[model samples]
Target: MIDSFLTSYKIILASNSPRRKQFLTDLKIPFEVKTANIDEVYPDHLVKGEITDYLAKLKAAPLEKDLKDNQILITSDTIVWHNDTALGKPVNEAEAFSMLSNLSGTNHQVISSVCLTTKKQQLVESVTTEVTFKDLTPEEINYYIANYQPFDKAGAYGIQEWIGYIGITSIAGSYNNVVGLPTAKFYELLKKLV
Candidate 1:
C-alpha cells in the first residue's frame, strides 16, 4: 500500500526515537533519520493535543528549509495526560517514582502527535489512547524504578515492558499509540501524503 502512495518520494523521519524508526521499518517504507536539536517546549496555555501538536511541528521547522522537492519529513511527540495534567518524561528517579505512584490504580490518556512536512505542504495529527492501571504496590513500583529506570518514557512507563505486563489493567485505544506511535493513523496519513 505504501509503495503505491510513496513511490518516488524520499521519506525522512526527524526523530531519534527507536519506536518511531521501527514503526516505519515495520511498514517496509524506506526512511532516513535526521534529527535537529530543537527545544521541546510549549506555551502553558496550550492544552492537550495542542502541546504535542506544537512540539511535533517545532521539530520539523528546522528541516523545512532543507527539504528538497520530493523529500518528506516526519516528526512526532508523545505525552501522558493524567488528571488533566501532562506527565512528561521523568527528570529523575524520584520523579519517576512519583509519577508511577500517581498513575497507580488510575486511568490516563497517552497522546501522540505526528507532523508530516514537505516543501509544498505540512500536516499535523495526533491520537489519544486511554490506559488504565491496576493498583500497584510500593514494592512493585520500587522494583520497576530500580530495574527499568523509566526516566526516558512519558508517564514513567513503557507499555511493552515488564511494568506494563503487570501494571496495566486495560487499554481503550491503539496500544501502539501508548508505545510511541499510532501506526494505523500514521499509515493512513502517510498514504495520503505520499
Candidate 2:
C-alpha cells in the first residue's frame, strides 16, 4: 500500500536495532542502514514522552544536512517508565537485576518515539504502551538476565523474550511499540507524509 507513495523516495533508517530494520523491511519498504553517534541524554527535567521525543530528534539531528530532497530519514527512541522514572539500558548485570526486581508484578509504560525527517521538513510522534508484569520469582529473573543479557534493551528486558513470555500479564497498547517501533502508527504517518 505504501510502495506507490514511496516509489520515488529513498528511505534511510538511522538505527542499529535489528528489530526496527526488520519492521521496516517487513513493510516491504526498501531502506538503507545509517547510524550516527548521538548522545541519548535528555534534559533532567524532561519526563515520559518528552524524553523519548527529545532523544529521537537528537538521533536525527546529525543527519539533517545529509538528507537529500527525496530522501526520508527515520530515527527512534524507546524507554521504559515505571513509578515516575525512566529505565534505560542497563549498564551491568546488577542494574539489570535491580530493574527487573523493581518491575516485577508492576505496571509500567513503554514509550517509543519516532522521527521522520527530510531536508524540507520533520515529523515526530510517540506511542505509549501500558505493560503489566506478573509477579516474577528470583529464579525467573536470574535465568532471564543470565541468558538474555538484556543490557541493550530499555528497562533491562525485552517483551518478546522469555521474560516477556513468562512475566507479562497484560498490555494496553501496541506490543510492537514496546519492542522498539510503533509499526502501525509509523506506517500511518508515512502514508500521510508520502
Candidate 3:
C-alpha cells in the first residue's frame, strides 16, 4: 500500500534507531538508512515538544543541503517528559535506574517529533503519548536494567520490552509513539506529500 504512495520519492531515514527502521519496513515503505552525527543540545528555555522538535530538525539540517530532488529525508527524536523535566537517553546504568525510578508510579509524556526535508520544502511535526506506570519494585527495576540495559532509550524503558509488558499499567496515546516513532501521524503526513 505504501509502495504505491511512496514510489515517486526516494525515502531516506536519518536515524540509527532499529525501531524506526522496523516501523518503516513494516509500513512497506522502501527506505535507506543514513545517520548524521549532530550535537542534540537545545536552548534551556525550550520545553517538552520544543526540545524534540529542535533536535529532530537539527538531525535533518545537514542532510537538507545534500538531498536530491527525489530524496525525502526523515529524522526524529523522542523524549520522556515528567514533572516539567525532559528525560533523554541515559548516559549510564545508574542514570537509567534513576530515570526509571523517577517514572515509577507516575504519569509521564512521551513526545516524539519528526522532521521531513525534501528539496523544496521542510516540515516538522510531533506527537505526545501519556504513559502511566504502576509502582515498580526495586527488584523489578534492577532486573530489567540488568537484562534489558535500556540506556539507549529515553525514560530508560521500551514499551514493547519486558518492563512494559509487566510494569506499565496503562497508556493514553499511540503505543508506537512511545517506541520512538508515531506511525499513524507519520503515515498521514506522507500521504499528504505523495
- lDDT, candidates in the order shown: 0.91, 0.93, 0.92
TM-score of 3: 0.97
| Model 3 spans with C-alpha error above 4 angstroms | none
Ranking by TM-score: 2, 3, 1
lDDT of 1 by residue, 86-116 (tens): 8899999899989999999999999999888
- Candidate 2 lands at a TM-score of 0.98
lDDT of 2 at 86: 97
lDDT of 2 by residue, 1-194 (tens): 67777898999999999889989888889999999997788999999999999999999999879898989999999999999999999999999999999999999999999999988888889999999999999999999999999999999999999999999999999999999999988987788786
Highest lDDT scorer: 2
Return model 3's CA RMSD, one decimal: 1.0
Tell me, what's the RMSD of every candidate? 1.0, 0.8, 1.0
Candidate 2 lowest-lDDT run of ten: 185-194
Per-residue C-alpha lDDT of model 3 across residues 42-123, encoded as one tens digit per residue: 9999999899999999999988899998889999999999999999999988899899999999999999998888988888
Candidate 2 segments whose C-alpha is farther than 4 A from its true place? none
* Model 3 weakest 10-residue run by lDDT: 1-10
